[model samples]
Target chain A: MSPKSVLLWTMQAAVFWLVLFVPQLIVFLLVSNPPTWELVLMVATGVVGVVHTAVEPSWRYRVHRWETTPDAVYTLSGWLNQEWRVAPVSRIQTIDTKRGPFQQMLGLSTVTVTTASAAGPVEIEGLEHEVAQRLVVELTNTTQATPGDAT
Target chain B: MTTPAEVPAGLPAAPEFTEPLQEWHRLHVRMLVVRPLNEGVAMLVPILVLLFTGNGEKWRLIASGATVAMILAFSYLIWRTTRYRITEEKVELHTGLLTRKQLAVPRDRIRTVDLTSKPGHRIFGLSAVRIGTGQQDVPGTDGLTLDAVTQQEAERLRLVLLQKGTAPRAVASEGESAEPVPLPESEVISQLDLKWLKYAPLSLSGLVAIGAVFGVLSNYADDLGLHPVQDLWEWLFENPSLALIAAFLVGLAVVGLILSVPLYILQFWNYRLTREPDGTLRVQRGLLTTRSVSVEEQRLRGVDIQEPLLVRAGKGAKLAAVTTGLGSKGESNLLLPPAPLSVAHQVSRDVLKVGSDPTTLRLRKHPFAALRRSMFRHTVPWVVIAVGLAIWAPSWAWPIPVAILPFAALVGWDNYRSLGNALDERYLVTRNNSLVRSTVALQRTGIIGWRIRRSFFQRRSGLMTIGATTAAGAGVYHVTDVGESHGLALADEAVPDLLRPFLVDSTVDDQAERNA
Candidate 1:
């Protein structure tokens, strides 16, 4: 994960909160007799969303980390609830890189490594696009050399 | 659908591969008899209701007769069209008149072969064989089913599918008949004891059975012109007697106990676990609808010793295998019914072929911070509800939530007591939960991945939860609320060097390399 990931995360959070707020805001503005308490609740939601957008990204960036070795892939991610996951090379089933619209704009990509077990998937988010591609190729080559059904 | 010509010229012809390219065989002719009888019995209730309740209309009689004829014809068509065969490479089924679906599973992927003989099938000496490959998410993709085959044939298929590369047994000759040959010598791991029936009531299956009986009775209450439940409710309301209500509850409990004994006898009348000569663990149970479920020793990942609250109070536990291909539904992987905890431990040890029971090992308990976290999680909701009721609702409602706090605290402490994890040489053991505390002993080699998680509160408390993911039962077994460093160390040790790179202050350890 890069330091720039905090900015990306903040932007993502803002977009998420905005998606929730816009509909309620539209209904409140357009509807003739919207409840007073609903407006109060909506305002509270806006305040919480703004505070969350301000605080959560930097905290998550401080917590998120990822590493890979010739033998395994390791990752620690999540904000309020953090997860540390490890998948071995011998058990690697597939490796792919995904770039969302925001990620494309920021020149970043997310690499996901999956194994046979449903519980074993290590996703490394907010990486430099070139670094993500190189990591995917490296994982593919190593996994090919490993021999097993991976189940 | 594979023709003999598809075998290319260059490859060596394996003997088993060349054989069993024989013919696609139809289900046993006796299935025509079994299927119609089974269908007729299922429709008996509705048909009787019409014949007895209708106003003697001629069309009602004609409709009942026509329905029986349709059932017979449909069953015959099904039997005629369904064809299955086992080749050296795959087990194939080509069935369905309308759709013409073809389903096949490679021989190597076959995981479990279940033989079930419902009463109708048993009457005709037939058994239904369900071949499962463990990939059950798809609707009709990998599994193959042969309904109502000759008992001998079902046994033969079971042996052939489970022991890959083995030549299938010859079909029974003219004199041998439909009687299944006795299985080869097997060592009995556990068998039903008469005393074990005492635990049946505590298992709570009887309560479910009683509830089902009430549900059916209520459905017919209007037809019968009687509503005992409604009458009882009215009488209770008129009298307003606490003693009467308590007496009714006691009566219900007695009925539940009485009902459970017979249900238990029917379900597990001759329950037995045996290890066959081929290294398959077989469970044979049920009186009327006899079932034989086999779990390959190779696919056996671990065992779960489950203690449901009521059953645990009676010092009993149920045991089930956590294996690949045997889906958890139908309790098909169950090794032991609610039996004495001692017997469960002994059987678990025997099944794993371990000298000692890993589930019974003394596990390292989580930190006191874990207890604090659990207590807060468990009791805080009730306390908040109480405070809310005090502010917004009537005074009596607040006392109700306040009254529940002690029980919630007890549950929290029980949950804390159950949380522990241990690593033996061969197995990684974990136990948790209060309602149905399960101690799982998973083979260390079976673990394919590791996940360690920390909530914001957990981070503040210096606690983390570790999950060991396998391809077996439930996919992942978690060790909740352990110290972060200890969890990382445990993960590293469970699968050598799998987590070494992630360990903060990593050191090159030669121990794992030497073990490998």
Candidate 2:
């Protein structure tokens, strides 16, 4: 994982905290009824958010891995309840690449692989842009219903 | 300047195409008439209520007539605008007045053709033709339909769209030549047996239908100026207790049977499954609104026999076709109507084209930890609720927990009893249930992946959940709360060599399972 990806994650966390905390702070100030626990919660959330946004990505990078076989594309992801997903090459209906403004700034992209499974699509995030493009090409080729690739 | 038809887009580029494109076709004029009638039928109840109560009020009568007229006018307008064409290469549709939407789907990509006619459409001998590619159409459903066409036209369109002239069943290689076209023949595998209706009330759908009826009644109570359930209570309060109770009992019995019988008849009235000579399965069912669905035999992965709570009690189960595109539409996926277990097996075997039923595998029992995990899971919530209530209310709350304990225990015990799985050469059979027992006979070839999950609580109990990832049936068929080693074994065995690379020795995982 890129160090910039972690930076991007921290910015996202900061924005989320601002959106949530700012509203609550405004409400409390209007009422003049801020509780001590609210202040504690605010500090706790910030400290946890710092640890999560700054440190969690590298740990996540440890558990996350993706592989492709002739028959399927496998994704192993998650921190707590790890999930392993496999989308078969023959069944792959669509492959798409998404680059959010922040992700574009960070030079990262998320590749979404969709199949007929009810489990929903598998998204491989934090890929270097060049790698994401190549992945899309490979998957798109597979999705075009030509199964005779000797590769 | 040359016409577009003269342009040889590459003579042999389109393998599915042999002949040239057919001219564009518009729906029958009856579509304009039938479309409004369908909408009018939906508003029938409200109109009936108004007519019965309004006593010829001028404004009320005018409002009803105007609503019907507008609907009829709009249907005619849309029907006039819609057009569809069948080319050897693809099926193209041009629709919309203002939007000017055009959709073209290649012939090989055409997955299923559904022909359904509601009572209103049936009156005009029309059926709604939905050509689904088994994928979500971009923007809207205009990509895949002719709203209402003549029944004969719909049938002819279905045949034209589905015909694969030289489309190879096997992987196409270079230098393959003119394969002779075969004659079209259909063999009926299973048809609706009225005897199956005995199991209809046993289906959970009936109870759900009854619930929906009551819900609608309650929602529209004020509008209708009547609340039947509330009225019954008021009458009961005014009458003697024993006689009223007897009357209520009789009334409930009659209402339940009346409500369920018609629903069953309408749903499975002419249910039939047939196979075409060129490997296609067709299903036809329903009464008032008849439906006919055609699915390629290649798309069918397996069969799912679902025995809901009531159905299981009566030894009946509903059979559904497990296919790739068949996932989104639920009821139309029925391969077999709810019937005796013996009959369900017979139908399934016929559908699978095998002499023996794949579901009849001797399933291996789950480990004892499975039972322990379920018991602990079921018991904890009620126990916690009971204790909390006792602390708050002291006397009365204690009895609630006591009353709930045995039932929870029974449920958890039954859950354990219901869990079993067996892996044979061809099919992976897994059975799990508490209230509704769903035993799925999933084809091994259909399974593309395996998912092994261990939640915090499950890890503590040295148990895990394993499921097979398939394109068919709910995608994944899970075996929950099995011992960690056992679950891993099942996952490993599901698609051999696939999970082997991801997993280490079961002993190492069990240690991590214990730690977690």
Candidate 1 residue runs with Cα over 4 Å from true position: A2-19, A96-110, A126-131, B1-21, B29-81, B95-101, B134-142, B165-184, B214-241, B384-401, B505-516
What tens digits encode model 1's per-residue C-alpha lDDT throughout B1-516? 222233335653322212354579999998888998877885776677667777989988988889888888888889889998888679898888888978888988887878889899999999988887745334334357789799978887877777643332334353332333333567999999989999999988888898987887676665557888889888866777878878888998898888888989988989999997666889999999888998888888999999998889999999999986764446888999999999999999999999999999999999999899889989999999999999999665699888999999998999999899999999999998888999999999989888888988998888999999887777789999998778778888998877766664433333464567
TM-score of each: 0.83, 0.81
Query: Highest lDDT among the candidates is held by which one?
Result: 1
For model 1, which pairs clash?
none
Instruction: Indicate the docking level reached by candidate 2.
Output: acceptable
Worst 10 residues of 2 chain A by lDDT: A142-151
lDDT of 2 by residue, B1-516 (tens): 111223244442222323334788787788777877877776777777776677688988888888778888788878888888887578888888889889888877776788889898898888988886645323234237788888877876776677664233322532332442333447898888888788766664655776887787676676877777888778866774887678877776667766777888888788888986556789998889888888877767788888887777888887888775442554767888888888889889998888788888787888888898878888889999888888888475488787989999998998898888888777888888777788888888777566666776676777778777676657778877777766777767767766664566346755797899
After superposition on all CA atoms, how large is the RMSD of candidate 2?
7.1
The two-chain DockQ for each candidate, comma-separated, is 0.57, 0.30
Clashes of 2: 0
Evaluate model 1 with DockQ and give the value: 0.57
Model 2, residue B17: distance off in Å is 14
